[model samples]
Target: MQTNMFKRLKRTTRTALGFACLLIGIVFILLPGPAVIFIPLGLALLSLEYDWAKVWLKKSQKYFRQAAVKADQALHWFGKKLRN
Candidate 1:
């Protein structure tokens, strides 16, 4: 029916957009753009329709969290050193 056709169209559009963002993110990785943002955004969008993207998105989230913790620690340590 029309509903099924609409669903298919929506899925196709989402997939195309997700892949476009993902590819742009990959390119940005080497060109000094916002790869970090776009990559997760793409994964998030793709995850809405794909299990594989969901897995990868989870892993990326974990890695970003760890990186944030490390960066925060480094900043605190640096601030303490400056005070001494």
Candidate 2:
């Protein structure tokens, strides 16, 4: 069926993107930019088929959560005004 063919294509594309993201993440780590950013993304993509990626995604999610919390705290502190 045509629909079946489309599904296969979609899966293939997902797998490819997952690998690409992982490679980009590694490259970013040595060069510049937020390397951690791509790790989660790569894991997310890989998680579609692999169990290991799920674990990695969980870890990456935690890191992002912590970073968000820190950013929120920093913003709140900066927003506070000195009161008499």
Q: Best candidate, lDDT-wise?
A: 1
TM-score of decoy 1: 0.93
* Model 2 steric clash total: 0
lDDT of candidate 1 over 1-84, digit per residue (tens): 999999999999999999999999999989999998989999998999999999999998999899999999999999999999
* TM-score of each candidate structure, all chains considered together: 0.93, 0.67
- How does model 1 fare in lDDT? 0.95
Clashes of each: 0, 0
Deviating ranges (above 4 Å) for candidate 2: 66-84
User: For candidate 2, what is the TM-score?
Assistant: 0.67
What's the true lDDT of residue 35 in model 2?
73
Displacement of residue 75 (Cα, Å) in model 2 is 10
Q: Candidate 2, after superposition: displacement of residue 35 in Å? A: 1.4
